[model samples]
Target: MPHSNSKCWDFCAPVAGILFALAFAPFDYSFFALLALAFLFACWQDISAKRAAMRGYLFGLGSFGSGVSWVYISMHDFGGAGALGSSLLTGLFAGFLALFPALAGYLSVKITPINNGALRFILMPVVWILVEYLRGYWVLNGFPWFQIAYSQLETPLAGYIPVCGVYGTGFIAALSASIAVEIFQIAARCDISLLSHYSYRTSLREVHRDGPLKNLPPLIMLLAVLWGAGDLLRNTAWTYPIGEPIRAAMIQGNIAQDQKWRPENKINTLLKYKRMTEQYWDSNVIIWPETAIPAYLDQVNDTFLVPLGNDAKQHKTDLIVSVPVHDADPDKKYNAAITIGKEEGMYRKIHLLPFGEYLPLQPLSGFVLDMVNIKLGNFTPGVINQPLLKAGGYPFVTLICYEDAFGELSAQGLPDAAYLVNVTNDGWFGDSIEPYQHMQMARMRAIETGRFLLRSTNTGMTGIVSPNGEIIAQAPLFQETALTGTIIPMGGMTPYARWGDRPVIGGAVILLLGLIGYRRFFRMAY
Candidate 1:
């Protein structure tokens, strides 16, 4: 009630936002999201764009800074950079990411009419989603990790995921939060008057009669209808089997990043994989993690390939494995995985990690490895339209590390493939929950497509994921193990896989345009 207490509340507001985000992490307390929404609502009461943006930024900083601290482990422990450099890099990334929430908070305050609770509720989710979509594609490359919708994966609200994707789930969550905030405001009698330094000049008795609550019933009904439709879509079977089941094996070599590329360790790495695969030689298809070969295909010579190829052919097995490939014309290198079976070909990774794979503003080689102590620092981008691989008589989409996490990429590439195959090296993050979180994103992709997803990771979380976001099989973290499973390939597209995020993005754009038009034509006349 006092100014000093209000200041303290303002300072503590970001704590709610941070806790809400942390609650979504793997093995986290999800109930904190309720407190997060309350804090946001309190800040909304202030009705100042600047203050709202500041609160949002502070929240974002805490949310991402603590949740994604695993980035430091990758840069410092695995990338060969020291602790100070890793911390600096991680700080810069977190600071940049925080700006998106700042923008969302500012827009939410600017467009919301303080007296009109209905407008506030409607606009907040729309604005939040618009900012999130921008964050997914605004920079050199976008990082769409740990979106709020992801927290709903294990909840009944998860039904919304297939229809609108993660961003859509986020919109619903924000909308729910806004509704909760409005209800709180009404019950507490903390109206817009609380926001002003001078108050009680206007009688609330008359104002309350003509306010936004009059339209609340219809708005609530609309939300119920939309949520019902989402649930219906979730329960409906929109896809069918494209072909018979394919028996597959995913090998988890658990190779250390530091030792993976070492010449001295090459024999051991090769033998380890060979030994693991020998047991599963009868599998229709077998997969190894990203860069499992750990050397350029050209460097291997026939000495390596002749035996490997002949063995696969003799066993009548399809081996899908990753190796580095060198392009001579451009004098560039690429991280690639090729399928060796009845037919053999390669798929190069289209998206390269900025500093890890290639250096910016340099000649694509030498500089990054020399300066940053990271290995494999000269990979080139793959061709954009590479087709899905045909292995063991089934077409399968393949995604390398970090590639499967991009919803747009998966939507575009996986429709034609009978199922999705993701190979990654999560040893870079050590034993952090990051690997589990990353696997969860892959599961979301599966639900979006209605296709079974097979994920093979080096040093952890390797598993088979079904179309409903269920983990069919998985290995323990940091283990040298192999898993064999039967997966049925499905046909027919889920709403998301066919249409992608267009519906959600288009809805956001239309909402924004309509808001602009409304303000211009019907300038609030009091």
Candidate 2:
């Protein structure tokens, strides 16, 4: 049978994961993230690789199960998946994500000795972050939500965002947690006498006599210094303002998902947006939410869009709006955003949302979705390296919907694209924390690119984010409102925008390989 202490950690691991979710938006208990990871690190220490993997799996199951529970809302409330099917699918999805953390735990232990300090302090963080990068970027076309760095946006770790990006910041956060755990573990070893004596006085005396407590202060100080450095760097600006500030407005139509696409509601939707936008025509730029027009480009071009474009040009304002586009090939319709007035351009979405925009795994995904009564779009992805869309006589990157979640994709036009614009329809998730979480990730893009981000969304979280990841202005959820703000076009690039994730990911790869080589060499010498 396992020791009582080990059993206790096993019970606490899942609980810790639940607390970890609270560190993100809608709760904003940021420090809870550090405490939760430290608890997880404690559970993995001195454990067999298999046992560590199981604990990690449990933690992951709890983390994603609570963090992304909104998936059930989107599937059942909107996609028509019945309660039973949606619940099961959500569980299975969380379980699949859990495997990544399990892999991190297994690799951390397998690659280093269980008793080695490096196992807790070095290898653990490296393996954990690398696994996150893999799961966030590669698998299933990427689901980067719940990444730890997004939770640290308001913390000192945010200072590192413009320099190394989200993955690097996450690596530092995990490393900090591991180091704190190591200190606590050392203190625990020193106070082992208390377990037998049942005396608090004896434990204090023993802990001091063991001499580990003397070194504890220095380790604690070192952690403080790291945080201090981040705090100091927070004032550093990586990008500078270019031209004069322009007045911008984001129109949140707050359309009901159930009624948005109805033929009878189409004209009403267009007129509604037109009326709302007419109020902000004095602004230099006006944006409409994703698919606010409720019809294809060809359907509205002649009677509706042309007149709107003419009016925008007459007012000396640029209008950006989203509506589906019909290509010459009937099967190649795209979720696209277009600019009218001042300058004209089009950008089709490059990254399609898995399941929401298109089905994955073909027959299997289609079969399961059909059985669940879930229906989704069959949209096509646009070509890469497309030209930046121009608005108000300046170039900007266009990210339709969740494209802002992918930092690298958002940075592709950077150092050239003056700013970032994201148009999203968040009505599918309906009053859930998903919109808040989405807004959080989108703000990180502004930090990464060192540019103002204009986000227009349907049914909530339409806002403006400044270069340092601060929310400049935000509309209330499920409200029909227009958020107006000013954006200064930024002219330079942050290190993150210039190099992307290469430096941090490369360092991790090299460090892991070096550790493996060192271990093999010592084993052969012995």
Candidate 3:
């Protein structure tokens, strides 16, 4: 049994340590790479399930608490909430985010054969990955923000993204951590009895038959294969060139969230977008950020619509603009994008941001509403099978604001959309890296679907990404500007687009079930 101070430290240290690591969560220098190592160190002392869970939860709380602290900025700065309210809300969100890692830790210990060091090491990666995957899409509409795979955007490992999505990169990262831990355990063994008791069967044989160097070959080869394959895939041209290039213009009107809803600022916002659009009128297609029009579609009189529609038709161009729509359904409102041109239509956003768009806890929502200064409460979800809009003979799916962050949601609605058009108001988060992170998530979606992703954000990170997750063109942050580029919409699907995360989750379930069954029925011992 551990002492009180030791127990307290054990309980709290992992969380604090993880939080510290996440303080450097930008994509700069592989910060998460080091954080993963630290996590292994924190878990090294105790190999039990309970300890693992506690540590994992702490780690998760720290990682998410720090990395996503930007949420507090939005709530406090823009959500019309006071400091205390924002802090409380932030804590609640972070706590909820921490649950995924808690699950990972608990399940890893339960499934792993701790005494068999090799098996424990092998299974830890699988357990970690499965848990992360679950967090990405399971409970409460799934929040996959700040996934470890996001940090690998600039790394060679990113090549695997087109084939397996970000989740697979996470698996590889976790596996690398496991290997490092295994080495640490092996080095720390002091006695033959301890070695015999804790070492893996393979390790024991390797020690006795061959030297320590014998196992090194497999480890080196495994890493070499992962890195080598990733490099090879990175250089490979997985996407075929389209016969013709589609010229598009992305307008980044730097609208402030505070002034967005005010009646006085409405005209200013409209003019800003219109002026930017005029510059790009020659492009094949022009796009505006999310909720570019502050007023509902019905509320915007023909004065605004007629001229914009005429301009699009006269320019021989299609305009994809985001606007709030209030249909005949008096009770609901939708965030939607309408394409105005020869083939005019609309695509409503299916997945809405939980707290930002729709509050989950209705009773508590009222309390939050009273506390916060924001006027609106809920935005309705669109139908599951919403089709891609056709404009200028190009088929494309439109994702509003944070909707592009979700890999499955982006892929499911339109499998055959020539490409993706993501419209967002990242101005809510200001000049933070939140916009960059959001764009990174959008790139993953492009890779998953093997399509060109054209993201237009109000406060920069507006860019065009290729099918394999490379940024072809990007505007500087916090700049009110417009970028005109030619995007080749790729046809056909990557493995991730065809199946999505189901295969990964299904594989995990099978492995876990098979392990449970073998343990229960056959009484297999490691």
Candidate 4:
């Protein structure tokens, strides 16, 4: 039937996935990711396309299962789904996410040169990145948690972000891991005769004692050169300060999810935020977390918003707060951030969380809203293009919660928007690593855009990230506090903001074409 050892490799897939997840925030063992990727490459090498696809599927299950485990906490603990139901649903979601990787693995293996070592190595990285890009670009409610480049944020590879975006940085990372596998294959004295079944699968791309092994030293040196280049470019400034820095404050409410939206707790929530906002009136600007107000803007406009706006104007400060805005239909209700006082503007969220905010399938929207017993469940997505929100005389691109994760999407206001403001409610995730991971993603966006990113969150990670992705100041998780800091508005744009992910995808396409051309023309001539 099947080779006995093949069964063992199947289990290794999940372990490899776990190692990859361990590379990101909360774990911070980035070296483990290389090992994990190498293990996956090793496992797939020489295996049949079907077998490799199966292994890849298992790898994805492990990768997303551990990396996004916080999803379970959100669904059951906060959304009120039963533990068993949450676990099942989370499993299904991960399963769906896994298909992207599986698609890459299957297609990579299905391609010709199934026996060519250099060709296969080249193909793997290109295909992997193509899949990652597709996963994020697809309208199927993209969940780009822990992009490979994100793990490289602190590494020299991050220097590639401004030049090529996350995908290009990820390409370098994936290539390094693949090269490592190649090195191991060469050093282990893996001659064709002495080779095991594992080596056979990988041999098409690997150097045997006399074949591709001779090329290893040069390849290694090339890798060293790439890494050295990244290190050199890592700290270079892409954007500069324009006007005077403005003092800003981020208010973290630490509101519990279950009690947050209750009609009884609505007044208390407003009072809590109001009291906190008044304390920060001395600052040039005050920011409240996403959905900081439990009620719609209309419900409190006369009594709360107008008065707060007047007080903020009188105090010479700008106040921005998140609450619901319903023009008509509950399904048309929006998750919006409105600025009050000196510079007033409203930014409704464009990227929305499916099922969490609004069900993608319109028919189920009402049923889910009724079952969830939540007023904001049927919220709608915001407009595509809106001018930057002016706060403290600086233009800020405001992102709601998960929108910051999509760097390119956040850059839509670029070259015009001077800074970034992200408001999120991480209370749904409880005191888990989700907030930290989310904040890390937000920081990367700042680095990419060459603009300061200020994040105010409900129950945690209220902080300021500098243009270079460094955290200047942060508040404790699950704390009711205000994080105040001075942020300079930047005038110029980073390469990433000016261009976007186009360069990366464009380069990938060119490389893929070259590979295809070389394989057909050069090999056929031989």
Candidate 5:
């Protein structure tokens, strides 16, 4: 390749990354992801494995740096890290995330046969989705934010949410991107002489391979089936309306973090939520954001909890609030969801944030986590496989903060949960896009599970989401507002709720390895 040509590919790499970010919320031109990915694949053409990795990293850098820039705000503004230190840490986190894509790109080019049709249209997508899955499952406790599948919630591919989880949608999205490149490559060699010459030579080299366009029909047919099935699933009521709509109020206390837990401010926090909810007494369900009480469960019980629960019961309304619960280890507590009215049960958050919830490699990371107050740092992870909380005559479960960001973890509650709830305090990220992104991911959880989701947040994005991932009503950012809406309780499980992502991801792995094996076996024998 000419130096100028290579320069063009390098220059366009970050643009692809930035374009990929637009596929996600706040700027959801979901279809742009295909363009970004197809452009990226084109850039990789005739490139060495190392160059592919370099391009992938650059693409990832732009994607994560822009998409998750809110991490810097959360760290510098709220987490208490110094300006320079926070910026560096944020960059490091993004850089680390970029490595997964870098690795995927390198491995993909290396393992995939030379411009093989199957590799372009199928193998690369598997590798990308697998890398994302591994990255989410590996990084500390896990951060499942900003995945490619999360971007496809609007596309027909979203119909696959139940059957394959978000990863399946992502796989299709990636494959589509590759197909775009294949089509373009074919167009570039429009002359039959050029294509025939190239095809005849490549045919001898590739195993189970035909001309790129020749193999394209099956790919298109596969997409048509998956997409049509997704469209069908979109209209299909995997979960049916089970009960009458319930009046729910999401109370945003709007308590400033600095003044949140001061003994002097305890009265203020309690009274703020109390005063706000006093008017919503007629509502069947009232909820508070994560850690709305700003105190330990026992500490609040004497001064507020018991009285609040009794008041809710008296009003014939069900109230759910988030509070820190004292664990056996005093230094480590639980970020617990405790209910106090018509129906009562407790759910502690299972997927803990690495640096935020509990520092990994504590001795080293402890200092960084301590940059800010980290009031809830060192919190314990909730027990896995817990039953859903019952409220308002419907079985539901709560996802604390960004727990809903991971569809698989949230889906664990299954067919038993009729509605989903998310309690978060996005004030930590100020007025950035975090709240909207969080809300977007939460909405995906509802769609994946075939249930409605209620988000109660501190300082914004509090709303009601439908089973189809639509926001019914949402509160304004940084505002002290109560969001009230009626949500139908649904029953029955989507395929995702019953099977999770194992089947989808597992099939990708098997197919990818099988393709590699088939290629290798043919090379050895022939």
Candidate 6:
């Protein structure tokens, strides 16, 4: 049977979800995440586990449906999927992501009901963050988008990134939300008690006599400490700059997605990039966006890259550019980044975008995608332990497209990698917030590794991020321009770069186990 207030929670849940999406980039109302989570946590209270899960699913729908709506643009506008097909796939993708939060709500209630105040507060936040961690790394080759911690890059909670990475920061944020709801429940005791299965009228009357502010001071203090400590930590430098700043330039070609891969437009595209590069010959290092050369590496290696390399060497400047590599085996092609002039090296992308780079589940996914008239690449994955490529005489890690979203992957190149370079072509999702959201995630990587992040993207958001996650410089969206910035290569690793996500995830696992043990002991004791 549905509870009396189920309708209210059902309505509020999705609204809260929309607010949650607003807390992230482009909208960037950071505190809205806290409010949204608090509302959702409050909704979970006094509801059946099933009802909670349903409301959570609805919240997920609202959040991802709005947050990642740009997926439809990429599929329909660029990938040739019609509007109906694109909408269906986008909705399906959002629906699938919603299951993560549904699992969180269900497990949270089943583990510890809301009536047990102290236990519920701790267990619920732990369960929520563990589920978030799972959704980020374990599911679907890892889509770490819209993780609550990403929204906190501008907040003091960003201080937690260098210490414990995204999951840990997210855990703190979830804990803050849960605690806020508990504080409200304490203040408005009767309202929550009336909604629940139990009648606490007499108990509330006694508590009312004592006043509602009895238990709030400790929680308020704790909240202050968490945020205050984060602010203090923000000033702590985890990595130190080691050498003279290198003058780097990033070229944004603003190539139209539809015309980018056309055979006839290849010459024009090459000429445009060459013309842009010729102007920055004095820069210590110059970068081009992903697959700047629309054709295969072999097709233009002799006629184009060789002459460009010779010119770059003559000018004593290093060039870093991305192109598709056609290996001897046709099936072994890669989306690779190559360094020329002062050094010659290549780093093939290790983490391939599922469906975008290659279809998983082989013939099954291929057939389904074909039915929707959506075409995807069939690129090969590179080895994980590939050597770092050098630019401007400094060894740096390179990420192609969305790979920077995986913070631990950026850390893997650490201590050794002096700075970071990410080449992206966000042109597929035209005139949308996807590029901005992507840039936000990339900034989080710079914080985690304490290294300058040089992101060269086609069409929009070509920029440089400092070690502290601030944008040093940015090129305007949809512009044919070059972003010039100074990058000081840092020589130390942030705690996150050294330890990765193990401590945070391991702590969550231990807390969950402890909760299970406490539940069993409580049952036995009673």
Each model's backbone clash number: 0, 0, 3, 8, 3, 0
When 3 and 4 are scored with lDDT, the better candidate is 4
Provide the TM-score for each candidate, comma-separated: 0.89, 0.94, 0.89, 0.91, 0.92, 0.95
Alpha carbon lDDT of residue 473, candidate 6? 95
lDDT against the true structure, per candidate, is 0.77, 0.88, 0.73, 0.83, 0.81, 0.90
Query: Which ranges in model 2 have alpha carbons more than 4 Å from their true place?
Result: 1-5, 192-218
In the range 1-526, model 1's lDDT, one tens digit per residue, is 4331266656776676578666665755655664575566557554678878887788788777877888899888888887776788789878878888888888877776555565666787788778877877555466777577777677656787777788887788778777766665554564665445334574654354455444455556665776676667668776789788899999999888778888999888888888898899899899999989877888773777657877989989898888888888668888898888565878999987766676654564355445655554767889887978878788788789888777767877656778888989888888787887788788888888888988898887899998888898988888789988999988888777777788898988898778766655555563
Candidate 6 residue-wise lDDT, 48-74, digit = tens: 788879988999998999999999999
- The Cα error of candidate 5 at residue 235, in Å, is 1.3
Candidate 6 residue pairs in backbone clash? none
lDDT of 4: 0.83
Question: What lDDT score is found at residue 198 in candidate 1?
Answer: 36
lDDT (tens digit, per residue) of candidate 5 on 60-170: 998898999998998777766678877888899999888877888897778776656555567778888888888877767667777888888888888878767888878
Q: By descending TM-score, how would the candidates be arranged?
A: 6, 2, 5, 4, 1, 3
Across residues 169-202, which tens digit of lDDT does each residue of candidate 4 receive? 8888888888886777666554655445445456
How far off is residue 13 in model 4, in Å?
1.0
Name the weakest run of 10 consecutive residues (lDDT summed) in model 1.
206-215
Runs with alpha carbons beyond 4 Å of true place in candidate 4: 1-5, 190-211, 328-331, 361-376, 513-526
Model 3 lDDT tens row, 1-526: 2331266645665555454445333444555553564454336344667776677677767777767778888887887788988888789888888777777777766765545455556666677677777777766677777676776766777778767777877777667666665554444443455445445745655563444434555766686788788878777665565447989999988778888889989888888888878887778899888888999898773878667888889889999888989878899888899988556788878888877788777778767767766545588998887767876467887788887877777677445678888999887787676876788788878877778889988877899998877899999887788988998866766777777777776776777776656545534543
User: In terms of TM-score, how similar is model 5 to the real structure?
Assistant: 0.92
Q: Give candidate 4's error at residue 342 in angstroms.
A: 0.4
Give Cα distance to truth, residue 89, candidate 1, Å.
Answer: 1.9
Give a tens-digit lDDT track for model 2, residues 405-492: 9999999998898999999988988878889899999999999999999999999899999999999798998889999999998899
